[model samples]
Target: MSPDIRDEAVEMWFGPQHVSAHGWAAKLTVVGDFIVECDPHAGYFHRSAEKVLEFRTFKQGPLVLERMCMLEAFLAEYPYISAVEQIAGVEVPERAKVLRTIMMEASRIHSLQFWWGQFSAELGLFAMTLWPWVDREFFLDTFEELTGSRHAVSFSTPGGVRYDFNEKVLKKLDRALQRLEQHLPKFKDMLLRSPTFRMRTKGIALFSYEDALRWGLSGPNIKACGVPMDLRKDWPDLNLAYDLVDWEVPVVDNPDHPGQSDAYDRMVQRFLEVETSINIIRQLLPQIPEGPIVDPKARAKTNRLPAGEAYGRVEGTRGVTTVWLKTTEKAQTPYRAKIRGPCFASYYSLKHLVPGSTFADFIVVFGSLDPYPGWWDR
Candidate 1:
């Protein structure tokens, strides 16, 4: 409120050049090591993916969607595929349903592993960073063994999945899961029990359940506030095998801050997410029924969708991801496509979360949300 304080405020941009901020930037006004104002910027990584979707065929649409967040490629592409199946009235086979669920959960775990490492590194814990990344490569190896590509696997399609689970694919998946299980406990203790880690994250970026919902935050960010708002349970997809598995949604109800989540709560929430994904995959793997991998009429049904609009939604790695599609009668491509990526809200919330914190804790606030640039940029 004083003229001296106003005159001393310094403005700075936090990235597109910062090592941690790959394709995003934010402007912060600081006064004596404390942030006074924050402005989060987007469009640095935008490729106009929604416009590009209109030119690609229904089958090709998922491929484009996966690129938006390759860390969760299998989960990212499902919304588009689900929309196509709705318009086409295609039935996915039981085998494909189980396979899709398994791969999607695997993708979720892999994505969380990446976030775990990156968040640790952002806080200057370099040893914690490399540990999870080494484990993440096992999941990538499994994906490559199955689909011949790691990040952009193009595994799922409308009415079913493109690749069936072969013996080699299953073995690789088993290996990855086993490796993760063996090491996750040690890694959890290292971060969660560390006094230094707690000092940095415990009270940082605090948000209430009401504020989170108002800002449209979901997934672990909201779950950390003791709310079980996962689409996999709330709005179960008929084509996916989540109904076939018995697992509870992972949530972190921090007693220290009831109905609110701080940076440490979010960190604990992600660890729980990885565990739940593992449980889902383990249960579904053995239950894969003997049947066709895809519908026999999928090709004809999806070739030219009838005039209709459909919305597809999934509980993605970060939050609720969705694709709204419109098509004309006998159209090979969509009339219009709209994508809603969850990180848009998380990134925007920095304007509110950063101002009261010290300048050094900016990345702590951002990393806790587990935001991916492609999710917002696309």
Candidate 2:
């Protein structure tokens, strides 16, 4: 190589196993330590989610959806449940609606906590790891008490949730929210305020607002770019009971950068969302109505929706997670069923950010965008 050239461009793989590679792996073409191109790789874990759901009855489908998103089961489960309930023409009780909102926000916090922990570790903030997990127990405890499991929470049924809300779990949720709120500031101080984080991420991995719209980035990813595209606010499901709550959707912006989408902005938007989720949980618990959790008519697989089709979507912890289902009177099972996850769209956009940044910058950029391989590849 010439002296001016320094190093010839060579390809490198970052994870599926790299310690710093947060979610999955990516292939990178690098000149020295700088990446010239990037290709994110997934499918290391694929269970054929749609195919598994298609053959099962409506009541049994959530079991498969829950596994698709290991980090946020509610995101996958809610959309499928809503799709089936809509097709079945089952009315979700008012109590179930508020409870679902509580779980959704809780799950949102759960997902962010996991992301933050990994991102912090990537930034060499080992101390940051302990706090999120310490606080996470409160959320998991609430879930375990509610559903007898911590991770794969297949809690929602077709018409409504499988379990009823109890005073003890609500009390635990209340206490957990308080703990999370109190501890939230430490993350901001340790990571967001750290010059290292800002320097590494503030303007790196930019996705312009126009690009966000064109590429269909959703949730906090697009919201960070000032797109104002929250499914909860823009397309609220009746069962979501979003109308019952009073909270502003946060489209986080970097006042310093002005009309920009960067890794820092994305992280900040999700950070703001974490606080919003806490507030939502507090707002909802007092207002949850007292009634049966699920209609008896909905718990069974025999309940047939109209032969037509319906699509159900939720403002997932990730983004606007969706489910499409088609039914026919000729057979009890769904004729067609599938899920659409948000991470899939953002995956292709990786090369757009990866090239023109250093290899280390690639990790920060990828982690900030928070792509999940498992969400796709199925």
Candidate 3:
């Protein structure tokens, strides 16, 4: 608050150039090693995806959505598809429901693996970084087998899915899961139990459950604060098959923090998220009935949707992702499409969470929130 302290504070930008920043940047005011202020920035990666969605046909909108967050392509694309399905009144078949759930859970696992590797690398644990990424390739391989593309596989479409689970696809998916299950224990022990990792992450970027909710945090970030606020259970989609499986929303109750979460708790929470997703996939895989993977009249139905408005929400890998859609009568494309990405709030919360922490730990706090620039920039 004093003039002398202000004189000593040095202001600097943390990226559009920083290796860790990717398509985002932040302005930080530092006094020696401690950050006196943080101004989190967005818009660097803006691609007008929401506007682009309005131009795409009802059935073609998922392709644009998937590109926003390719790591969870299946999850990323579903919200748009969900909206289109609602407006068109297209019924998703039982077989399609089961398949969509299975692949969505698989996409969740793939995304978590990518996050684990990236977060570890940001913490300067390079070895831990490559370990999970190597395992992640198996998931990519499975995705390739299923949709003939890895990252931007437009797997989920309005009224159903684009691809059916062939025996080859099932075999590849099982092998990927097996590899992840086998290596996850060892990876967790190596990273979570390490003294170095604890020294960097434990008790860092701490936020109470109430504060997190106030900041609009969700997914593992909220789950780590001892709240099981998962949309999969709380707001289940009738078209999806989550209700068929018996599963509980994973939550982390850290005794030391008591209704709060630190970086360590969030890291643990993501591990539990991956496990829960794997369990869901395992249960749903067997129940995938032999029938149509898409609605018989889906193409005809989605050709011209009646005038309506719909909200599509999904419990994504990062958090609660949603799409709000509006259409005119006999419209070939959406009249309006708006996306509410989970990362936008998480990135904004950095202004509150980063100040008073050391400059070196800024990335740790940012990465702990698991923000993807596309989520916010769009």
Candidate 4:
């Protein structure tokens, strides 16, 4: 509206249709070809999950939380369930612990595949997206066979998991792990060898070691920045057999790149992480001790936790998802429940990152980070 504004600096809308946009569009003010500012508008799929949870029984809250991040539903549910169990002082059965770990790993790969493949697609490399999706579907197929749902699995409950795993699910899991292992190299080669991907992403985002820590980035985003901090390893309440698995966290802060944490590095970091995750799954499956998937006596309903406050944090696909719960001694519902989603932190960084970059590059960076907008808007 001002004479000082560049003629090309009109606001452009990246509508909800784009894959990376995650069904939420932005009103971006552009000057020439660079995005000067972005009004990120979400609520496209706002279900008001927290408000809805108040109405459901305590045992039914996991279903509400799982939808918070459909891609990483199990990971999202873990902290919430853990909070409930801790508040109620419920000791989960050993079999349920192993099943929870297995489900967590499966969800991690499932969500990473989406991030890795979408990164390629956002860069206009169709094959990178297609191959990984095809490969990822193999894993989803296992989830479906096991839980009877591919995504938005409400398999988890407050006391323990809602159902049990039979020999059939175990067999399916074994096959899925093998397929994922076989496909990992192909995914890596497809992303790593692409010159376009490398050129576009390399040395772009540039969040330094201190900056990453300052911003409180986590998961692959932090691990990619040469930090070995993983909540699963840092906090052992997860009851994971991480020590049994031989894998390394991929940390790459190339001096040559010189504080440049670009889209390429972010992508390559995921490539490395995916390989690590696959290797971990391989060792975990064969070593999976004979046990029930859930506590045989655990009730599917009417499992009320203690009356107290408890917090649970887990390394979700995007980052740390922390669930806080407050319970009343004689009540069957939580007095208060809150979620600190990692994507919410990443979304704030966008205000700093989006400007000065082309709209397309903004999309590239956004996709590479793979923030689950649903987690934030919910």
TM-score of each: 0.98, 0.94, 0.99, 0.91
For candidate 1, list the clashing residue pairs, or say none: none
TM-score of 4: 0.91
Regions of model 2 farther than 4 Å from truth: 1-7, 300-302
Candidate 3 lDDT, 238-263, residue by residue in tens = 88999999999999999897999999
Which lDDT values do the candidates have, in the order given? Answer: 0.93, 0.80, 0.92, 0.74
**Candidate 1 lDDT trough over 10 residues, lowest sum:** 291-300
Q: What's the lDDT for residue 51 in model 3?
A: 89
lDDT digits (tens) for residues 1-378 of candidate 4: 356775657877886886557567777899888888877776887787777766667777888888888888888888877776666555666666667777888889889988776777778888877877887787787788778899978877765676677787877777777777787777777778878877788766667667766776777777777777777777767444566666666676766765446677777777776667767777777666665555534443335555688888888888888888777766677777887888866766676678888766887767767788787777
Pairs of colliding residues, candidate 2: 15-18, 15-25
- In model 1, how large is the Cα lDDT of residue 115? 92
List model 2 lDDT by residue over 1-378, tens digit each: 345443577877887776675457788877877777788777777778788877887778888888877678877788888887777677777888888888878988988998888887887777887789888889899998998899888888877788777888888888888888888897788888888778888788887778877776788888898878888888878877778879999987677766668988888898899988887887887898888888776656436656878898888776778889888874567888877888887876787877888777777876777767767677
Q: Residue 306 CA error for candidate 2 (Å)?
A: 3.1
In lDDT terms, how accurate is model 4?
0.74
lDDT, residue 330, model 1: 95
Q: Select the stronger candidate by TM-score from 2 and 3.
A: 3
N/CA/C clash count, model 4: 6
Cα lDDT of model 1 overall?
0.93
